[model samples]
Target chain A: MAINDNNTDSNKSQKQEEKDLPKVVIFLPPPVFSLIGEESFASNKFLFLKAYDSQLPLLQFLSTHSKSIKAILSSGGAAVNADILQLLPEVGLVVTTSAGLNQIDIPECRRRGIKIANAGNVYSDDVADLAVGLLIDVLRKVSASDRYVRQGFWATKGDYPLGSKLGGKRVGIVGLGNIGREVAKRLEAFGCFVSYNSRKKKPYVSYPFYQNVCELAANCDALIICCGLSDETHHMINKQVLSALGKEGVIVNVGRGPIIDEKEMLRCLVQGEIAGAGLDVFENEPDVPKEFFALDNVVLSPHRAVFTPESEKNLSQLVVGNLEAFLSNKPLLSEYVD
Target chain B: MAINDNNTDSNKSQKQEEKDLPKVVIFLPPPVFSLIGEESFASNKFLFLKAYDSQLPLLQFLSTHSKSIKAILSSGGAAVNADILQLLPEVGLVVTTSAGLNQIDIPECRRRGIKIANAGNVYSDDVADLAVGLLIDVLRKVSASDRYVRQGFWATKGDYPLGSKLGGKRVGIVGLGNIGREVAKRLEAFGCFVSYNSRKKKPYVSYPFYQNVCELAANCDALIICCGLSDETHHMINKQVLSALGKEGVIVNVGRGPIIDEKEMLRCLVQGEIAGAGLDVFENEPDVPKEFFALDNVVLSPHRAVFTPESEKNLSQLVVGNLEAFLSNKPLLSEYVD
Candidate 1:
């Protein structure tokens, strides 16, 4: 008895349909894909070609299939720069699974006429929740007290030294974008006085804005860095800014690591020049300074400000939606305009 | 040479004045005194008689100066029971340097016609700050991730598991009291959907009210216990409540520990019946279940939700104010009327 040719033909065409799908080369899998998984993107109109799966080297693989690459998916884990773009001359777009553009070469993408799509406003709530969490952790000593309890210090030693209160605190937010505004809203409910320092003062905002970050740091009890990492903002919180913040001041950074001078901040923390710090990002990720480990006044996280399950789901849908929109010649869901 | 007898006389007079001042017996100093020293109260018109200073025991010290004992300064550290009150025949007032009356015997004091003053509404902001902090810690894995980073897991292991989002979560406040209201206000800014369970439905309030704790837990993604420890509230959160809360639910207790049946909660956590817990108060405090120490999902803290440098300062004034008012025949500042 011969097997039905109909089933065989259907299977062949299914394979053909999957093979014919337009390619979006993933030179690097985003941290988001690690969270929500890339399985959802497979249901879309595009086929993701994972460059790492090829036995050939990254450059050789990119050059071997240059004609097939119409888009590049990037993140903080991978840099989509001029060299990578040079190999993929047919690439028309670059999509980043991150809120910031620091990982990707924006000027190069612009000069090459490549449209960029990013995770816009999808992670605002998650980042804001973590910003407030870190602030409270630093000021209220949540994690420090947790350590005390876990180590059985409460039974042996006693209550840890009292932490400062968040209420009535003057909190200055640097780079008051979506994440900053969300943080300000949460802090306001905690009865904190909110102020902001952006490159230029935002119109229609009620908060008191300072043109200078140092002035903002000087006046506020705490400074929360929510700015992007760029040439202007890199090491923005230098020694002078930290000195102006004074000994009783606290800082919470959910933004990029290098935005604050890490070495200067470490010295200030060690010397009691600043009261405490809560950092979600580091100057060099996965290579945090060992100095931060012993400090009770600091709460360190593994740069997970935007990795909540809800945000991850939202990001997965957004990433797939942006790629599908691009493949269908539709406007990007979250286009990154310079 | 004859020294000035006038200088000696002035010193003698000052000593006499201090000796003649009314004495308020301090049997056991509250934790507040640990944060802010007792020196502030020494400046008052009345002299605080430190019972621990005498060679005699607490009871003997109280009886030796019954005539001088018109008031007792008490705290969570010492219970103001009928045993202690019976020693002071003239004691008409009991002042606690804590927010809750669980540390004091209210019925015994009420029967003897003794007035009670507490740190009313003073620690509300501090407790609320910590309640939100613990909620954030449990939901966002703040303390867990802190440990992960502290143990240098991020370097060896890439990223910790994603935590749940606080926004759009149904947060059930167990008590609609001052601290609960404050917590609700803060969670609202984080975009949480708020409901409550109080003894009586509050008028002019808009949140959904569940009279049953189990029902509240059933509907909420998280439960924040902010009620006091009372006859009706003892072990209010039992096995049934934890079961109703299910596997996705989290809990935070800034209230007295006995409010939740800890053994049942522990079983639920161990069995994965409930997601996680953040506990500041325990049933047998300073002796937390060793099982909790090993659980990454739980964030343990000493009973310090009501403490902060700012709150301690406010409490110092309030404690002294209530005592001064009692001595001066003015109304008690924060009288706990039965």
Candidate 2:
């Protein structure tokens, strides 16, 4: 009750100060903002109005602050659909603390002439680090062998099985975007030959490109998925593609789960059709297949490829920069024009 | 009885043909030769006479064939001591299927004017690969996070804890030998700053060298031990060095275990003085401390850093090459002059 009373007093003071500051509405608080310590974002130039904190419904909350709220802060999980956009007629800019903008209705924002800013290549290094980490884990059996050592099997079982060497492996990267490029750079140091499959061959990239996913999988020892999920990309890693990867091949998925057909890939892994997989995302997140728990070859992560503390700090800075730029009528730091 | 009778017939034929070929005495059959397939080493130029296969005792077996044995093939576990050398007065060369020459008495061999050949850099790349693998596994908590996921903690517990990034980490190599140099090369590709501590400063190397190991531990975020076990290096990584490494420093040992003070290191790890460790060797392998099984931060490997199929094949080739060179009086292929 004492805390509630203090919050009410602060709310009253905030209302009084709202007229002097630029108001920015946040649909849902990103995990990074909370992690980096909220006090770091305290600024006199802009006021962050959290829509989730309001007692009223989201639509009602937007209607109440529509005239004053000119910029919106959103995230990957929060929907920035046309319905919410229509409620805030004065909102001129939308800033997201995520690299992917699939949740946002880009066409609607374009029609309304609302500029969009995203956490661009800020997370590329972190995501790429995880992708390579997972690849090495799968290939070298780092996690499985650790389990063997932890379970007191090393002393009793004698020698642990030999792992395949990382050097001289042919790795095919799916989607040679920022994250994919970073992954390629790291793996190249291990002596792995890198090739890629993308929508179109990148202008400056000299890595061999395969237009078809199956062709890429067939030619390489492993495939790392780093592309975004879309109607065209959904279930792109299907049964045929998994078959192409073959019995001695590996697959590491750091991209959106729907980009791969999770059910088929699971069957392939269970049946030993493919050697192994290291997955950070699933078709339905936090609902991994039970079969994966029993499999030693596969390593499962709970969608944490982009959740390092350093990268989170970078994302927080980008979010603040975008908000500040939009308020002062300057160009957005990471504006996504398309 | 039938198998023994067949072996006797083969032994008689082997004795008959032994005089026609150059006789090479083997102290023991190395695991690499067996792994590479015994048929691969079958040659008419030199007949390998396994000392263990002789029905007589070792000394009697050596005395019976001493004059015929001009070259001796030994390994890490099989000692080529002064007694064995004195028995085989004709042994002018000692070929080892291991990189380290600790098992062979170097002074006695030099006094007898006998040449030595070792596995050389055949296993260096494989050992370096495991060192990097262990480092990545420890820093990223790859094995620990995998255990969390396997135990179904991801769904119930939500997001796993974030891992530290590999880039920008200061890694100090304990030795600047072939294996150590390979580790530095791979880590450099990950954007890690490499430094080193060696017996003497390597002239051509540019990385900062620390003559004192305690000074090296104090400056580096991680220490990778890659030196051989010797009188000077025994218990080199003692309490003072581990303390200097501090709370967040990681230690990876691909070298001999006695190089680190196992008892003190364990106490420090248990007490949270040092962050974590990745160990491929132990003070007494096949008898690891029970306490290590319970620690999630430590990754234990069963002394398998140098064992890989590719490296095993390379070792097989080197062993054959050394034997052929010794017989032809052409310099021994991986001759260890020191």
Candidate 3:
């Protein structure tokens, strides 16, 4: 009789179901939850604790599962703020499926002595590959040429306009981090001279560093933004920098949206203030300026730089691996270091 | 009065005007003529002789001015055949702006002891750059993503499907010539391990060489056709090799059309027997199979791989340099050997 009542399931109290759950729960929110849904939607998916979408307030929910919540899985869109971190005393690890730790409160986690594991260099290759792809698309007109062919213009029109060359051109890389270095490596292979603008000069690196981004823009034929989005880097590629880049310069952004001033960039690209642009991210994502729709010089890619079937599968493994390492009291697979 | 008479020139004979021309004249044809017009169209453009577009037959034209026509400027769409070469016995040099010498009668020119100058490695970088561009465009879905963003589908239609990764991909190049080697160089920089199926194994190269194209297709994640169009290579990438490439394989063609079996490839791509293709050259370019227009996996590029502003400028210089060398009784800038 009791089994029959429980089997109906509408009678199963939320508190009772919560009580029956095991310890060491991993919390998932918006982006990570959806990503996990893509691959881990099949079976045994009950392992992930999804409390972010619950009826209770975030802090209240966190407080309720405070003891059992051993780790937090984070990614784009949702910020793992300090208050949320503070509520979970047992939360020893924060695993983000993103290579960039912009959404995570790094300072708060550092203060708490809670370890953070990120996607690390797993996404670096894919992101850098896209950056190079966009660069070639812009400089060599890959996307435009594709459009021309797809539209049956090749048969009707005489030729697509000539594109700029990659070789012998000066290319400036922003951030000079893992992704930037990867871009530099690939661009160098294409015979482009790679200089960079980082927060500070990296030691043992041969690329000429410019402290001021404007100076970097003025010197380079193309500027590829690979820096993470932070207050210091927000709108770092502004009107002044774009102007310095001049009419012959192209800019490729694989970094976050706000890293460049999209309004100014749009105007610059439309007016031919800059030669062209290859943009993956915009000021407001999924709402790329409609002005870019018809521009042949601009190659607009919806923020998909870090995505590839292989990379996402790799990321899932990495996310699971990081959480497993934390639970087993083993070293983190990809511990984030500032 | 005498200047006016010459300036009007109504009574001037064609032979009289031809008599005014120089003893040694370089020829101009369709593709080369148009390409030369792109760069050298300013003032002294009358230097290059015009004969290919004349009312006279090619042989009659060559025979009429055999001694005067010292050099032939060749390019795509026009063939420098045995009869034309035989008629112009005094044609001391043949300068082709194309790196591939397939259009020119090599054996006939060799027997006549006429030196040949071609665009050597000037186009290799641009062609290789485009090959890599198309490769990344296909594998990373660069062009498709661009379309998604451009069409406002990203905001409404949700995320674009994930693309295959370039990193750790086993890429097989059909030809290990200058462009193929350069493509290999660029792909290696992107973390793609490159192998090749050339006419024969290249000396001093470390990469694995596949004697059989089917074996190469079987082993690789992607295949890039860079071989010249000739008897041995025409339709070489047929059903068997494409089938060996499997369902997950991608192919890129920067070589001339007809190197791959176009109809079979269209079938493979439509049926998903092969993953996708990035085609810069189609069997009948400017008239690509209309079926390819609707395929998201296929990135159709209007055969602009060898044409970039900088590369074309470089080519013009090389063409002029080769012609100048021939006229001055000096060694050619890019003398063809075989």
The numbered model that scores best in TM-score is 1
* Decreasing TM-score order of the candidates: 1, 2, 3
TM-score against truth, every candidate: 0.95, 0.92, 0.90
Clashes in each model (backbone N, CA, C under 3 Å)?
0, 0, 0
Please estimate how well model 3 matches the true structure, expressed as its whole-model Cα lDDT. Answer: 0.83
Q: Candidate 2 has what TM-score? A: 0.92
How do the residues A164-189 of candidate 2 rate in per-residue lDDT, one tens digit apiece?
77788999999998889999998887
Worst 10 residues of 3 chain B by lDDT: B38-47
Candidate closest to the true structure, highest lDDT: 1
lDDT of 2 by residue, B114-211 (tens): 99988899888878888888887788777888788888888898777777777788999998898999999888877799999999999989999999
Query: Model 2, stretches more than 4 Å misplaced?
Result: A1-15, B1-19
lDDT of each: 0.90, 0.86, 0.83
Q: Which 10-residue window of candidate 2 chain A scores lowest in summed lDDT?
A: A35-44
Q: What tens-digit string does per-residue lDDT give for candidate 1 at A82-119?
A: 88899999888888888998988889988999999988
Residue A2 local lDDT, model 3: 52
Quote the TM-score that chain A achieves in each candidate. Answer: 0.95, 0.92, 0.88
